[model samples]
Target: MKAIVHVGLKPGVLDPQGKAVADTLGRMGYDEVHSARIGKVIELDLEGVAKDKADARVKEMCEKLLANTVIESYRYELVD
Candidate 1:
């Protein structure tokens, strides 16, 4: 099975990196742009794991190590 994770800052959290990008975009003749947010993607390849079991395992991975649950949230998709 293959697992793909998308990690990003949760609402109400300050994102300096995202803010900077937004500011730059506004100054670059793109004033219509209001905001920009940054995120990450992680892909994992696993063997012997059934698709039915991948969601729980992948969620565990995110909560334990893949994502900073304190300030970020994550979602995962599994593919066979």
Candidate 2:
């Protein structure tokens, strides 16, 4: 199984990097972009775990280490 995790700041949290990118885009003539947010992706491979167990393991990973949980939120997908 394969796991894909996405970690991002919660809404209402300030994102300096995102803001910088948005500002730069605006200056570069990207008028369509009004704002921006930044996030991260993590991909993992599992050799022998079942799909159900993999889901729990990935969720635990996110809660314990992959995401801040307080200021950040996370979601994940499992693939064969």
Candidate 3:
């Protein structure tokens, strides 16, 4: 099985990196962009696990290492 995790800061959190990207885009003439948020995508492959078990394991991985729970939240999905 494969798991894809996306980790990002919650809304209302300040994202300096995202802001910088937006600013650069604006300078480059991407005026349609009002705001931008940055996040991470992690893909992992594991064996011998059911869907529910895989979901739990992936969630644990996010909580333990993939995301900083203090400022970031995460969501994950399973793929074959």
Candidate 4:
């Protein structure tokens, strides 16, 4: 099984990297882009997790280490 995790700053949090990208885009003639947000994707391979338990396990992983829950939010998808 494979777990794909998407982690990003919460809406109220500041994102310097995203802001930089947006500024660069505007300077490069991408006037359509008003803003941008930076995020991370994490892929994990599992060997023995049951389908029913996958969600809980992945959630735990995010809460424990994958994401900084205080300022970051995360969502994940599991695939076989």
> Each model's C-alpha lDDT?
0.92, 0.95, 0.92, 0.96
Candidate topping lDDT: 4
- Pairs with backbone N, CA or C atoms under 3 Å apart (clashes), candidate 2: none
| Candidate 3 structure quality by residue, lDDT tens digits, 36-67 | 99999998988999999888888889989999
Error of 1 at 65 (Å): 0.8
Task: Tell me model 1's lDDT, rounded to 2 decimals.
Answer: 0.92
* Clash list (residue pairs), candidate 3: none
lDDT of 4 by residue, 1-80 (tens): 99999999999899999999999999999999999999999999988879779889999999999999999999999989
Give candidate 2's whole-model lDDT. 0.95
Worst 10 residues of 1 by lDDT: 48-57
Question: Pairing residues by index, what is the TM-score of model 3?
Answer: 0.89
Candidates in order, TM-scores: namely 0.88, 0.91, 0.89, 0.91
Instruction: Supply the TM-score for candidate 4.
Output: 0.91
Error of 1 at 63 (Å): 0.6
- Alpha-carbon lDDT of model 4: 0.96
- The candidate maximizing TM-score is 2
